[model samples]
Target: MSSAFSLSSGRGRGAARLAAAALVWGLATAGTIAAAGTATADEIPQNQGGATATIGDLKTYGSAVIHENGEDSWVSAGLFEMSVENGGMLQTYGVDLHSPTQRDARYQETSWNGTSLSGNAKAGRIRWILENSYPQVNDLAALAGKAGVTGLTEQDAAAGTQVAIWRYSDGADVDAAAPQAQKLADYLEKNARDLAEPEVSLTLAPAAVSGRPGERLGPVTVHTNAGSVTVTPPTDIAAGGVRVVDQDGRAVTSATNGSRLFFDVPAEGADGSTSLTVQASTTVPVGRAFTSETHSQTQILAGSSESTVSAAASANWAAKGAITALAAQKNCAKGGVDITAANKGDAAFTFELMGDEHTVAAGVSETLTIPLQEDQVYDFTIGGADGGGKRFKGVLDCKTQGGASGIAAQTLSEPSPASVGGSDGGTDLAETGGSGLTPVIAGAAIALVLVGGAVVVLVGRKQTPPQV
Candidate 1:
């Protein structure tokens, strides 16, 4: 009986040891756990900083060139080229030095979109206008000359050039690009300071925003691991201006004429900002000499596989969420976010904002605000869901909006295959593969298995019968 009991004990011990080893193995190697049914869900990819090839340096001034060499998203691809709109509300006083009818160097000026892309590259129609065209005949004539070299005669030894300035909506321009160059000559002749109220140019472009939604950029990804968010332009509207606020309706961040709203994880104990509004404006000069355009866009994050959204998804109330998503509206309906898993098991979800904690049901959407602090960080968690006999889960999406001229989130096509869980929520257990587990969970499992195996080997040798 003693021998039999020993045998039984040994077998039981071996089984327990083996189970421990397996668990350890699963934890030690996150990759293995991911492959096993112990872990599930897609690990958010790291930022590699790569973009498309056809893109070019979008900025026409300074060292602000769009270098999309290593960005790994669609924003980088579209940002290669920017939409530029130039308008000026200049007020000139104490100066009538140049003649409207005579060719004068004082009024002659030159300007450029700052790019040599050529007419073919532009592909669009060329427009020109004089916002306040009634100073003097000589000045007007000089302006005309600056726009284009229409005619030169023996009577006029020095013929002026007409200038062109691109206008959208309600105005027109003279020279397509160098209107100022030609106009400057005339202004100089008039001896005018031309103290213009800062010429207005709306250069609209989608920015490759980084970090998690509803949070500021940060370096803590463990319990604070949140996914990235993106701001995309609408197809029908352009983003002329951008601003951010907190939940209390206070201003947080403001972008000038040409800027974008980027996303990131905020630090802990961070007070979230509120709504984001994008001012979409087109400088429609007072005259109809030129055609105006309607600028709009749908915010889309390239390389980020999101779910389909319906009209209901448009409902997001979180101001901070709206800022990150760039939604035209400030709220999202219920269950707007969707989740799916590659398998089933332990999974970790990192949410960047407080409101993001709510799980995305079938068709609901939620929105929240992060206090306006560009330098703060925020993080949240999503609970795990039962694979329901399938695999995968988590908040696949969060929809929000910025005002007019702001970025927007992409809509999902259909219901996601997985369920979204929050860290604060109760876990729904359903065994499958480890693909759903967070990276940390998988790594821990593997380490445990390796340790167990070593212990089993050591104990087994000591129990072996004496050879001599």
Candidate 2:
């Protein structure tokens, strides 16, 4: 509980000059942050922003006094209008605003949502007090009657509620000026229970990517609090000998926070795109706050409830026509086949044709038919629209004018060289560092709106809970 204070009527721009005196205000350590009209449980934000609330309209139930440290201070019993930007006034019993203020006095907001309630028995019990007590109960007239006060003004109820909050929020003993108010506070102090915090949410950065048919399309990074994430891609990728690999192109079924991911596209893969999703479920512990390099304060907005969050990313590649390899048997030639590389798309491509560096222009095809004395097996690499390449292997042999076709199957190489290792010769696609942005749990709980008389309809924004 703090000394008596007051401010103006409404909220103005929050970009106020940092109060010259650092000790002027303080806030509870926040947890599980979210903003109003900006981010929500549904959509995501890159990072949580800062939030603050200004206090004003000091109303005294009777001239309540707080007994602290062998000395008593005359303070507003409780019940003040907290003006938040975008949000309206909420009858607030401040956690701990260090000193008395005159106008536009404010604090950095925080939440208490951990299992231990920021490791404070008082804070957890305080949450219990709010949920079960008068304002939250929203039956002021009945509650006032129970406390032995008829026609109790809402301000008096706020004062009563605040005094009760102080018993737990501050651990400070309070003597209410109004009999009914003190009675309510006394009833609540007997039973204060903790509320649970909310589950954490996350989002993937650079949700989409593009590449050539033979290139590895990513290094997509996961930004989250969960221990591990489940990676799910289209079935065809695994069926078609393609895969989602890591930075080193090694296959992984699960990923953790900060892991880099990529989609390996086989050379023969048709020009198309697919999306992969990663999901995780997590919970944020409790909160602690500012006013120092080490420790401060925190408040639990609402106890957490478990929920799952996920993010999706896409990968698209160029078509096979842009870069392809071929081995056609030349029947009449001395047991030989024409090994070729072709570029039928819009861009020029370079590849190795028969151990020789070759460039094939759009609509152009290059063939090298070797007249071999013996059936020779050969490997040919063709470059794609991008520098990425494809390797095709087959045996070349001519027997009796195509009498017994000697060459075996000639098709795209599985686990495209670019995916496993640098086997695509000098035409292999280069590695591109993954996206490093993380949109994790945070909020700039903004705005302050008032809902009812002695009925605490709360509204505020969130940001990443600060670590102190």
Candidate 3:
């Protein structure tokens, strides 16, 4: 008799191995493989090879299961898994459900090594969560809880399933959680991310003081992600490593992660309380992956003796884009913005197309493209929009085709290379190493302030004004 099993080739040749294993299992568990006495099972295989593998041997290194039960056909596998060879590759999974509460299913790779593990859920819901936490490997249990899967007990995890090893379908898969975690363990080692160091900044208002360390100050705001929390410190609090206390001066949070001790006092007074004082500090992690740096700040109450405490921590800012250029402001026609090397260091000016906000470093000419409205003059100030002390010193040259009266209106005109604005109604300006100014009539000069907040304009009578 011709054998029902046959050898096949190509990408899915591995499927043949699975089939052979199932066949062997059936024959060994029930009847003879060559005997024609018993009939074939419902899902019979038409094998063209004489392979003798069994179902138990077809065990996958890992797998994931998904299920739902809301509709009529509320019974099917959402996502399943199969073993892959030579590292890894995508493969289809199948399964059968034994309940009516199950509706739909699909598979997703969450994590992996050699064994291919995956999971399944309502496609739409799971997809939404993944997109929101993009580039973050959200814990499966957490995601399920967020999706209202209240009864999703851990028992499901025992169903021959494992977390799937997710890989980005797109080229950006490099930083995707699974890949990144693997790289951290495989390559980065010590040169990777680390926990933050604790720091503190305290602002306190006077209140009655009392505690184990003795009567101190009442509760005060401590900056934290959970919103500002209330904190009280002991009167005996010292700088660098002070114990945390409650309003009655009781210790609360453990002294860890580089916690320090310090306090601040409010400018105003508290009833019978000494000048409002605040304490600050943080705890340091004993052993961590990366080194952490600590910092703190405090404002002492001039009169009140009460004190409050707060804490913070430092994280790595070594990442290149930790400080990067923000979006550039677009300019009007007939005018262009000039930026030099002096403006390069400040990340804020990197993406700005107009004005010389960046203080050009050296040996480089930073150029900018600013469009201006016809007959409009703008005085671009560069220090800081909010007036923070940072300053920019340079004038931009702008020209267009439209000229009138003393200056002819033309469609296009060459930019007169000038350093600063013109003087005494003169159309010419001087250049001081490309950091000069040019003055022209017929438009409003909008000064681009780089300091404090709003821009401050210095109006002049259509003539070159003093160099700023």
The local distance difference test score of model 1 is: 0.18
Preferred candidate (TM-score higher): 1 or 3: 1
lDDT of candidates 1 onward, in order: 0.18, 0.40, 0.20
Those runs of model 3 whose alpha carbons end farther than 4 Å from true positions after fitting are 1-262, 265-468
Provide backbone clash counts, one per model: 167, 33, 120
Backbone collision tally, model 2: 33
Arrange candidates by TM-score, highest first: which order? 2, 1, 3
* Cα error, candidate 2, residue 265 (Å): 17
Tens digits of per-residue lDDT for model 2, 1-468: 111222221111010101212222211111111101112111111111122345444443333455444433334444444444334334444443222222344433322321112444466566566666545566887776666667776656766676776556545566566666667777677655665532223445555455566778767778767788888765744225557889887886889888988888888866655657776554322221111111111122221223344666655455633333222323223344444434444565544333344455665667655443322233333333232233333322121111011110001112111111101111111110000101111342222222111111111111121111
Cα RMSD for candidates in order: 28.9, 29.5, 36.6
TM-score of predicted structure 1: 0.18
Local accuracy of candidate 1 as per-residue lDDT tens digits, 118-229: 1112212111122322222235455446434333221111111111111111011211112333343244233322222212112212211212224432111111011222
Instruction: Give Cα distance to truth, residue 144, candidate 2, Å.
Output: 2.9
